[model samples]
Target: MTPSISVVIPVFRSRTLLPHLYDRLASVLDGTNAGWELILVDDASNDGTFEAMLALHEKDHRVRVVRFARNMGQHHATLHGIKRSKGDYVLTLDDDLQNPPEEIPAFLAKVDEGYDLVIGKITGDKAHSLSRNIASRTVQFLVGKILGKPKSLSLSSYRCMSRRAAEAMGSYSGAHVYMPALMLGSVPADRICNIPVAHHPRLEGHSQYTPRKLLKLFSYLLVNHSSIPLRFMTIWGTLISVASLGYAGFVLVDVLANGSAVTGWPTLVILISFMSGTILMSMGILGEYIGRLISENARSGQSPVFEEYP
Candidate 1:
């Protein structure tokens, strides 16, 4: 029988917290009195995470587990998990205890109100460090602006979507997987809504998101999800051309008024340097876009799932 809901979580080096997370999910899910399944996608967290997932499966048959042969990143893990789910509704949550499983009902409530996709916006102060918080906000702001999402709608991994939306998002194929981008692009904006949810401190370990990962995520959004780069390059190149023309007229005036363009070498060199820098910058931006295009088209194999619990 198809479960009423499926909870998909991507785990990475988080074995220690799995038991606690599972217990909370099991308790809350039981309270709902709805048939549900927990799908845990271990993203090659070879640090005994698979063993823990298997332990959960042994404890409860409703706990499904799949471990990647190699690290495929969190979003890829989630996409796979959701695809494998057989549920009328799907919830994606972090493995960390920070995203309380208790909040699941709030998301369900919103989804029941005709919302196809309901995101859990963190209420009050977040428990992340200042830098991480800033990075999160920056990414959220960029997503909202680029995706043309409403200011009231915040993006979070702790979100719930209808089975129809989940299947629609499965149509997405890319080398880089940004969940928020995929969610926004796949679902209609009008059907999406956000509700306040409590965010608690981590029980153990720390955030796996390093600065490098955050920057890569930001780059993914900018290059893969937005045409702003090409548009920016166009406007930037046009302005540079106009500047060059203006500089040429200045040099012409200097030559005609002062006999020769000998003293114009300094400004000429400056202009050349500026133009060179702009050209290189534009080329770099174009290269990123082309790289993503080639990547998505040329992208082939992925790390296989070697283990799944019954």
Candidate 2:
């Protein structure tokens, strides 16, 4: 049977949540017009997760398993599954059950309304920690500004993409995966829709992401997807230059008007420090962009080696 929908779930030590997730997914997608296949990418889990997935595959032919050679991050695992999927639409979600499988139909419905992508938006109380929430919101704001999308739209892994969108996204190769931003770059805003979905507390295992990882991901997006950081650096450098000129004029006037030598070493030290710091900061921003370009070109020139399962 040809599957109309391909559901990709990235698994990292998520053995405990499989049973309930499978049950809910089966119930919700059983009678829908769209035929479905679930692709689970095991990110080199050492907790017998691969064995469990093999068992599940034996029990149900619709469930397919792909094992990574190493613990590539969640986004890499997702890309792996996307490459293997044959369905017309692809949906990616977490294995921890934070995103309910019941909402899959709603996402599909939105996608059917001619939208290239439909993202799930969490409404009501958020179950994440305050710091996590803040970090996520900050990412959302920066992503929207950089991508020129509406700030109100939230990007989650629990989203559905049309076949065209999936194909467009499959061409992207990067260590960092901000799917929403990537998709926004390829597809227009009007073609994207946001559907409200209920958020739930995690039923098992701790979140794999930390605040530091969040910041790192944001930095990657800023460096890779947009030049806003460089623009800000340019503006900052101009402002500092203006301020320095103003201060130098003030010092000259003071010296000339009072007929006294300016003898404060501290003021000279502060001015030099500020100016040097600004110059170094601007160079650092430029360095980041140049480094990213170099790395991307290197990766593009190299041939990726893939291992096939027996």
Candidate 3:
């Protein structure tokens, strides 16, 4: 029977949680109206996650396993699973138990309301660190400003997408995959809805993401998804020029009114330093755009190598 829903879980050294996760998912999906299939993408997990998945598949026909040749990022694994899915709707979530399997029904319920996307929003205390929480808030703020939708909600990896939304998202190929930004670009904000989901402490290994990774992800979003930084530079350059002209006028007025030299070497040095810094910053932004173009071209020339599952 064709599955009505495909649940894609990207696994990377998450073997310990698979048994528990699979059990919970199987139990939750048993009573649902929608026929379900689990798409487990093992991103070259060294922890024998592939073996576990194979064992599960042997016992159950609804489980499908796709093993990657090497470790791709979580987004890549997600994309791979989605591409391999054969269901009318797709749900992507972390392999960690933090996103409970029980909440899958809630997501499906929201999807039934005719929304293209349903995101599980984490609110209140959800076992996230203070630093992570602050960083996430900052990312949400910047994403909203850049996308020109101040109210655009921040989306987690735990989301449900209609077939149309899934296919639209699968077409996007970028250096970094910011799902929220991609969804916002491809679908209207009103088409998206959020339901609060239960968050649990990680039952297995630690989080793969670090603070540095978070910053790099944010930088990628800023560079690729929005031109706000470039626009900010333009505005800043104009303001600096106007300020310098005003300073020059003040100096000339002082010279004329008091019959004295208007400045010292210190003033000249400060002006030169300011201009030099501004020039470097402007060049840096240009270089970022150029680098992205070059990278895109390089990626276009090559096919993504993947190891076939045995």
Whose TM-score is greatest here?
1
Candidate 3's residue-wise lDDT over 45-98, tens digit each?
Answer: 897889999999998989999999986678778877877887788999999889
Per-candidate total of colliding backbone pairs: 0, 0, 0
Best by lDDT: 1
TM-score of each: 0.84, 0.80, 0.78
Candidate 1 residue-wise lDDT, 1-310, digit = tens: 7799999999999999999999999999999999999999999986899999999999899999998998878889999998888888899999998999998988888889988899888887679999999998898789888867788888788889898888877666666788887777677778898888889999888899999878888878887677667667766766776676567667666666876536667467557856765685676567567756744552332222222389
Where's the lowest-lDDT run of ten residues in candidate 3? 299-308
The CA lDDT of each predicted structure is 0.83, 0.78, 0.77
Clash pairs of candidate 2?
A: none
Question: Which regions of candidate 2 deviate over 4 angstroms?
Answer: 249-310
Pairs of residues at least 3 apart in sequence or in different chains that clash in candidate 3: none
lDDT of candidate 2 at residue 83, scale 0 to 100: 67
Candidate 3 regions exceeding 4 Å error are 148-154, 243-310
What value of lDDT does candidate 1 attain over all alpha carbons?
Answer: 0.83
User: 1-310 in candidate 2: lDDT tens per residue?
Assistant: 8899999999988887787888888787786866889999999999988888888899888999999988767777887787688888899899988898989888888888889889889896567888888887877888777767787677888889888777667766666666655667656677888899888999976788876667667877787667667667666766766676667667667766875554775468457756765685677668567766745653463233221268
